[model samples]
Target chain A: MLEARNLSVRYGSLTILDNVSFAVGDKQWVMIVGPNGAGKSTVVNAVSRGAPYTGQILLDGKDIRKYKSTELARKIGVLAQDTPVGYSFSVEEVVGLGRYAYSGGMLSSKSSGDAEFVERALELTGLKELRRQSILTLSGGEKQRTFLAQVLAQDPELLILDEPTNHLDLVFQKQTFALIKNWIEETGRSVISVVHDLSLAKAYGTHALLMHRGRLVASGEIPDVLTRENLTSVYDMDVHDWMRKMLSQWEDGQSGNLPV
Target chain B: MKKREGFSLVTYLLFTLAVLVTLIFCVCAGSVSVPVKETVSLIWRAILGAELPQSTAKAIILNVRLPRVICVGFVGASLSICGAAMQGLLRNPLADGTTLGVSSGASIGAILAIAFGVSIPGIEGGGTVVMAIVFAFLALMIILSLAYKLDYTLSTNTIILIGVIFTMFAGSIISLLVTFAGDHVKSIMFWTMGSLSGSSYGNAVTIAAAFAVCAAVLLSCARELNAFAISEDNARNIGVNVRRVKLIVLIAVSALIGVSVSIGGTIGFVGLVIPHMTRMITGPNHKKLLPASIFAGAVFLMLADLVSRVILSPLELPIGVVTSFIGSITFVYIFYSSRKGRG
Candidate 1:
């Protein structure tokens, strides 16, 4: 479980996140939804202990800042919105980097179990076939999968994902959420994800948090917080009509052909 | 898996062998060429504590060639390691000591010593190296502080621009010192342009000791460097202390460049070209690339030193000049080829 209290982040005079608070329960998938620049990514970064925040973030009843980096890493795996890699590491090598903290930052220090974890992650993410390929040569979708596999290889108690499905195809997008859902069921672990796909969030999330203009507008059960009213006000648009229209079109068997 | 293992093993052996062969050849083929067999026997005898058969050859090997060869090897290794670390730290393949103005700043320090006759006690090879190291560290601190003040957004363009400006600033100061030196300008210029022929045992030992310490620190953090090659934010998420890693890398790399320039002057291409070439073979994993670049750089620079001394016989070419010529050609070729691949 994770809890963020009165968290605020600022860059010079600009306040990116102000007094935001949220809690994720055991095995819960908390999907954070917001318009552009609503500080969705900032919240994830704050939890990762990368960005300095004014307030406290507690993981399993302990302040996240109190934990050593390697300790935090063993418990939390993060897939940030933009993971920019410059090198041409092989897919296997990239995935193996997930074991860095555990392996004491040396490949020679890795145990047999770490290799198994990497292989398992590669297989789960459908990247086993491309394990030997250069990561620089991967397509957008393949690269995303590779990074996701890396996160999986960390084998953490919690997963923090910001836009985890951005570059994924429809099939892998579904597969990714399914994999996370399976992880929750199997290990009772939690996931905090910032996603733009409202439909997927509504379908898969156990809880939802709506943010608007650096403020948390709503937070509760997914169906409760993702109501038409909260959706309309947070986005500053009429979403009820759009939802009804889309639902009716889907019911009429005409939505499947819609282009991505 | 087995094939990959074999490939890396072969690469390791090839570079190790190349460095060894090049070292022997460099020691043998200077202005006073020694026969290969004779050179080997002399080295063997020296190692065994036996008196060398020929006194003149012994003097050449022990006094002149051996020290120069050792200095060149360590300097080459240090420069390439600095290059690899800088590239990873900045996440820009083009980053090197020369581009970052560390070398120019060092040259200014050395040239100032030549101009004003400043010397530090206990430092071997005169005050040139001592001053060079001081100025190199100053330049690094300035660049680091500038980047930090700008909120640490060290974009590739920003870093390159800053490096270029710093280089020009250092260059002007060097020019001022050179103008003031008058008759000593030739010596100052030669030092700046890089020449290993002037190296003595004291200079070699100084560089070798500093290089060993710096290389150990850098190689120990190779995994951290690999993480840094990606974005700093990602490295942090993966449990790396980005700020700490950056600081360590900066210090280690600066020390490497300072010691190297102290011994070999601002040898241009060993740092810039060797890492790029080594990465092509090692696939950018710093664990392998770091050591590979060190050996490859040692071999390449020793060979260049050999060519500089041997070609034109008695007249020595500035080692930097030869490296720059080879480096520029190779750089252009790499650039165009990579661009063509992209297109």
Candidate 2:
């Protein structure tokens, strides 16, 4: 299980996240949904220890702050939104870096089991064919999958992703979500993802947290937190009717696109 | 895994062979034209238990050319290794020994020592070796202090700009000292233009020792440098102490460049160009790049020194001129090829 209590983040004199608290139980798939500037990414960043925040984050009932980086890496895997360019590492080499925290200071030497895990990560991410290609030559969606492969190679008990579908096409987005969903279902790992697309959140998420102005306005099961009224109130846009229609169509095996 | 290891081992063996062949050719082919048999005998006699007459052949082969060749090789390896480390630390392919202000600072120190003839207090009677080490360390200190004041992260543009400005500052001071001290002007000029004519056994030993020490220090941090090759935030996330690693690398590179400049006199472009060529052939992993660069750089300088001596026969040209001319042409070729590959 992963939990946060009274998480607050401030940059200089301005506060980005104020008193945000939430928890995801074991084997739960939680999605954080919000509009722009809602501090959704900040919450994820705080939980991952990427930024300084005044709060307590616990992994498996132990305070995460007390754990060393290698220990933390063993427990949780985090993928931030920003993807760097100009790196010349091949796909397999990049995935191999995921084993760095576990390589125990001898990064060049690999155990036979570590190699198998890296191969399995490539297979799971559907990137076995592109394993030897340089990372700089990959398309954006392929790059995202490469990062996903790296995180999966880490084999963490908890997975955290920030805007994992931003640069992906529709097909890639669906494939990626399906991959994550299947992994979580098979391994019974806890997942927390910051998502911008409400449809993706409704489709794959088991639990949802709604944020507005850096504070959580709703948190519960997907049906309870992603209702028509809550969407309208938080986004300040009238999507209630459109959401209801899309929900029904999605239920009936029809496309879920709504007119703008 | 087996294949990759085998390939890397083959490459390493080939590079070692190339370096050995180049070193022998460089030491053998000079202007004086000592016969191969006599040169080999002279070298064997010097190393083993034999008595060879001190003729012009033995003097030229053993006393003059051998030390110069050794000095050139050591300087080349040191400068190129420092360039590789600096580029990795700054996360820029264009960073070099001079980009971080080490060359300019060392040149200034050498010029001051030449013009004013000020023997430092501690090493007043220790001759040129002590003076060189002192000046080199002083230059390193200045550059590191300035970098610290400017907030450890110096952008590529800022670093280049500062390099130019500091070079000008040091050059002006040297010029002022030269105007007042008329007798030492020629020596100072020769040093500034970059020459290996003054290399001796002392210089060879000092530079070799310093290079070995500095190389070991930098190689020990290869993993940290590799983590830095990704990104600072990513490196930090993986528990690398980014600031401390940067400081150690900066000091190591500065010291390496300083020692080279003190020995070989401001030879440029090998530090900048050799690492890039190594990266092109061996990929950007520092583990391979650093060792390959050392070998490539040593061979390149050895060949350049030979050309400098033999091209003009009786009149020896400064090795710097030969290196800069060849290095620029090679740089242009590399730039064109990389662009073409991209296109």
Candidate 3:
């Protein structure tokens, strides 16, 4: 379980996230949803100890700050929203980088076990066929899957994903959610994701946290936090009826009718 | 996986062969050309501590050409390795050892030593070397801190721009010093233009040792450097201590550049050209890139030194001119090709 208590992040004079708190229990998929610049990513970043915060973030009842860099990396693997890789690395090599913490972070420190993890990750993410292909040659969906495979290879207890489906198409997005669901079923790992797709968030997330203007607007079960009134006010739009129709459309097996 | 393995193996073999051949070629072809027959045996005898022939040949081969060639090899390798590290650390393909104003800073330090006979007491050329290292690190630190303040991140563009500004500032100071230098101006010019005429056996050994130590430290962090090549945030999230890696790389590179500049006087473009050239052969993996750059750089510079020596036969060309010539040509080619690829 991961817990954040009154977390606040500021960049000099500007407050990025203010007094936000949320907790996710074991194997729970908690989706944090809000409009752009609502500090949803900041919440994920603060919990992962990627950002300095005023309040404490506890991982399994221990402050995450107390953990070593490598130790924290082993426990919590993060896949950022916009991981723009500049160099042309092979898909397999990128995935194998996930084993850095266990392998001592050296060029020759990888063991046979690390190789096995990479292979399994590639297979699980359906990237086995493209293992040797240059990542620069990958499509947007394939690249997203490549990074997801990398995170899976990390084998962390907690997975923090920022906009996990940003570059994905409809099919890859569904596959990504299915893979996360399967990972939770098998490993019982907790996941905290910043998601823009409310329908996917509501359909897949066990819990939902709504944010607005660097503050937590609501939290709890998906239905409670993603209510029509909450969605209308936080997004400042007439999204309630549209969201309801979209959710019903998804449930009715008419996913194509929903907005991307 | 198999292709990458085979490619690296072939590159290693090629670079090794090239270095050996270039070294032999460099030892043989000089103004006082050692006989082709005597060259191999002379090198072998020198290596085995056998008495060299009692002739001017021994002095030229052992005392002059050997040290100078070895020094050039080490300096070339040092520059190339530093360049690779800098490019990775800054996440900029255009970055090289001198990109952070190390060369200009070292020029100022060298000018001070030449102009006022400023020496560091114990070590020969220590004053220039120490001052060079200090100024290089100072310039780099300022750029890093300024970039950090600008966006709370060490933005690559900000660092590059600031480094260019610092380079111009150092240039103006060097020009001022040259105006007052008068008699020592030619020597200062030669120092900035770079030459191996001042190299000795001791300097060669010192530079080689520095290169080995710095290369080992850098290679140890190759995995982290690879992660950094992707992105800093990605590197941190994957458990790399980005700051520690950055600090170690900067210090090691500055030290390497410092020692090389003190010994060889700002050999231009060996750092920039060799890495891009090696990167074309070996991919961008620092693991392979660092070593490949080292060997390829050694070969490239040995060949350049050969050109510097034999181009005019009697009057030697400055090594810096040769390198910059080669470097600018390669830079233009790389730039054009990359732009073409993008379009």
Q: Best-fitting candidate, measured by DockQ?
A: 3
Over 4 Å off, model 3: A105-108, A248-260, B1-17, B147-160
| CA shift of A95, model 1, Å | 0.3
Clashing pairs in 2: none
Query: How much of the true A–B contact set does each candidate keep?
Result: 0.63, 0.13, 0.63
Cα RMSD (Å) per model? Answer: 3.6, 4.8, 3.2
Candidate 1: where is the Cα deviation over 4 Å? A105-108, A241-260, B1-15, B113-118, B144-153, B182-184, B337-343
Candidates' C-alpha lDDT: 0.81, 0.76, 0.82
Ranking by lDDT: 3, 1, 2
lDDT of 2: 0.76
Q: At residue B3, what lDDT does model 2 achieve?
A: 32
Q: Please state the error at residue B7 of candidate 3 in Å.
A: 8.8
lDDT of 2 by residue, B272-292 (tens): 899988888888777778888
DockQ of each: 0.55, 0.27, 0.58
For model 3 chain A, give the 10-residue run with minimal summed lDDT: A251-260
Q: Check candidate 3 and list the clashing pairs.
A: none
Q: Tens digits of per-residue lDDT for model 1 on B1-343? A: 2122213677778877888888888899878888888888888888899866668988898778988998899899899989998888887776888877888888877788778888767654668777878888888888767766765757655666788899888878778878889898888887678998888888888888888898999988887888888667767777777778888888888877877887788898678899999898788888888898899888888888988988888988989999999988876776576556556
Comparison by lDDT, 1 against 2, better one: 1
lDDT of 3: 0.82
lDDT of 2 by residue, A1-260 (tens): 78899988999898889898889998888999988888999988887777799988887788987877767887888776755633476788777767666756433454457787788888888788898889878878788888788888888888888988787776666677777887887799989999987877887889999999888899989999988789999989976566555543223322221111
